[model samples]
Target chain A: MSGRAIVVTSGKGGVGKTTATANIGLGLASQGKKVVLIDGDIGLRNLDLILGVENRVVYNIVDVVSGRCQPRQALVKDKRISSLFLMPASQIDEKDAINTDQMRDLSAQLKEEFDFVLIDCPAGIEQGFRNTVAAADEAIVVTTPDVSPVRDADRVIGLLQSSLGEPQLIINRMSMDMVKRGDMLDQQDVLDILAVRLLGIVPEDEAVVIAGNKGAPVVLNGGSPSGDAYGRIARRILGEDVPIPELNGHNSLAKRLGRILFGR
Target chain B: MTLTELIQRIQHSFGKGGSKDEAKSRLLLVLQDDRLGLTAEEKEALRQDILEAIRKHLKIDAEGFTMEFVSSPTDQNKMHVSAPVQVGRGPANFSK
Candidate 1:
């Protein structure tokens, strides 16, 4: 089966790129689709730890590219979901250990066996980013509401537009209370600036931190708001037209007043 | 705060519209410049050079000349340089 390869990336670090990758990978797998997660951040691998399969990572992408192990052998299967798998990155190798052509070949090989191949790209516009971007057929850019992350996301979006058409956006760590208080940038504000299609908006749920700490994706348990948001994202990925509910509750007077007062 | 600063704040939001607005405005300018890849001064210089070069071969209405770097209506990341000129002379030679 010819599956779709998508890269999850953020130009800035600590903007939830890896976490989004793990959760979305799990979300797609839980829906009975064959999903494989590849940790593209070679030197600093985190997807394995986030997926709670760090100990089971006997081989990594470096070994596969170097011909020490085959691609299928490097895949670490998830205990919870039999369909979910991860190709962990090498902790000892640098980002330049693998080139773009090799990445493209490996991604093509993996796509033959999986329905969705999600590559967790590293931060920055360096070689690591190029390698991951070369492997993907589409892209998903993750960004927070903060200025720095949003600016970097814009840059990454421009690059992806030149390569992979238009990449979808995921606004993470969005705090509804702050948006109501006019203290934070809302989803609309971000969309206005980024001007891309929104895949999902994950709220600032404390459960995300707890899930990361526990080495399990938030979508696996299915109780938290973030999990529900990811489930909707997965449905959207599967061509389901699920409407995203606004967190600010239908644009109250605070938002209108703020808009008029600020002349925004 | 100074009187001018306080008045600006009052005119904007009465101290209620917080840093989010500031961030949005700043990001807008930065992204526009980043996508355009040229400053106002640089674009003016390039336009003048192009107009001079065009005037050497054909007669054109320099007053009605327009050049713009616009984002594509369909694609946000793509940019198009539109320089529509009104030619005044040489309709026969231009056809060749």
Candidate 2:
């Protein structure tokens, strides 16, 4: 079957691109779709750790591209999900370990087997970013509510729009409390600046941190709000019209401020 | 002035606000410049070229020269460049 290859990226670091990739991949696989999560970060691989399959990684994407091992041999199957797998990155090598051509070939080969190929792209618009974006048919731009990340996300969105068309956005780590208090950028603030299709907004939850510490994705835990958000995002990716609920509490002042600043 | 301080001044001119408003305004200004992909050096060079072209006819105050990018009032997607030149009284206006 001709599958979809999507690259999950944020221009800035520490914005939870790997976590989103792991959860979204697991969420899709939970629906019995064959999903392969590829860690395109190369030397700074973390998707395997987030998916709790680090120990299972023997041969990585670099090894597969360098002809040391076949792609199937390099894939580390998910422990809980039967249809989920991970193509881990090479931790020892640099971001240049795999070039654009090699990544495209690998992604195309995997698309024939897996229903979804979720590539966890590295931060910044460097070689790693180029390689991952080059392999994808679609893109998902993840960002937080902060200033630097939002700016970088805007830049990444511009780049993605020129190449892969308009990428859907995932606003991660949104603090509902702060939004209500007018201390943080709400979904409207982010959407106004980015001007992209909103995929999902994962609320700030302690369960995400705990899941990361345990090396298991929060979506596998099944109780956290962030996990539910990821599941909804996966559904949306499958052409389901899942509405993103309003996270901002009814604060008229904040709404006024949003209207004044964002002109929503 | 640094771009951050300029943005803060612009936001302050908008009157009462919160952290969210400040951030959105700041991002709006920054992303406009970012989308243009023009560096400060490029802008300065462009300013110099404009000064040279205008100096052929009218006198210009090079020291009082200012060029900056401001958010457009009508369209959020567009940017307006504000460069206020002080017309020099002296013919040369050179200290040397």
Candidate 3:
């Protein structure tokens, strides 16, 4: 089969789209698959920072589209992974710098050379969102388990189904402790409202924030729970039957025993 | 006090309940007929059809059941219909 193009997007900002894209790309590349991640956010690009290859970007997507450089020249290879590459977005250019046709052509060309092409889409349902999703074979809509993010994600999913097909859902930054306390929305509530197939659930972890600051994706750390979740998501994307990890955090056993012994 | 006045005074004695009683249940209903590309008349007809279908199938006991016509995200040729019924108990024990 040919390579697949996947777009990681969230309707609202600050829902961890860039982080998920970086981690999933790294996880897939670690499994011996050639992967290329395109930061489609244009002027607000941050995927390079998350991937730890910001200093190596000489050319970007604009250069490739404008014929100033070849696609390979714009692709910055990750030092930690042998088969991973990143096509950084232009920080100075705007969203209209590249049209949908150019993005489609670029994605098609990249698909010819890599096993997977993941596009990090910008937030909001605008031209940038359209351009990035225009070339994707599948789309993953990321949302936190809060009301605002979940509502925005529902709108995004509706748009995707109307424009494309049904996109997969990814619940990011979940907290099991909050769920246990009835202070946070659970995955079931999100699924009930979105009514889409869930791709994965990533728990909120402090290590993810630290990894972001250090310009390293959490999936590379391996010991972090969120990192392991992203690894499982990558395997699932490759059609592996990976089981969803327990999101009960470290208090699952204690909570269960308390419920059994105390009936609370 | 008169008998009727006595009942009213007793009813007023029960003040508003605690935090649990203060918590209200909300149902989010989305109407999507526009996305399906249906004309206004067709949408209205679909809405009427949905209400008629629901009324024909089940007996609505409470005053909270709402029926609406929604647009279909996938195909413009279709319309989505939704109905939200707020019964007294949780839906999991509806059979009882």
Candidate 1 Cα deviation (angstroms), residue B48:
8.5
Please compute DockQ, using alpha carbons, for every candidate against the native two-chain complex. Answer: 0.21, 0.20, 0.05
Better of 1 and 2 by DockQ: 1
Q: How well does candidate 3 score on lDDT at residue B47? A: 64
TM-score of the second chain, each candidate in turn, equals: 0.44, 0.53, 0.33
Candidate 2 Cα deviation (angstroms), residue A88: 0.9
Per-residue lDDT tens digits for candidate 3, residues A192-222, read 5567888899998999999989999999988
User: Which regions in candidate 2 have their CA more than 4 angstroms from the true location?
Assistant: A252-264, B1-16, B41-76, B81-96
Cα lDDT computed for each candidate against the true fold: 0.86, 0.85, 0.79
Of models 1 and 3, which has the larger lDDT?
Answer: 1
Better of 1 and 3 by TM-score: 1
Candidate 3 runs further than 4 Å off: A246-264, B1-27, B30-96
Error of 3 at A130 (Å): 0.7
- Rank by TM-score, highest first: 2, 1, 3
Higher-scoring candidate on TM-score, 2 or 3: 2
Model 3 agreement with the true structure over B1-96: per-residue lDDT tens digits:
477644433322221121211111111233243234467787667667767667665544335544444322233233344455434554432332
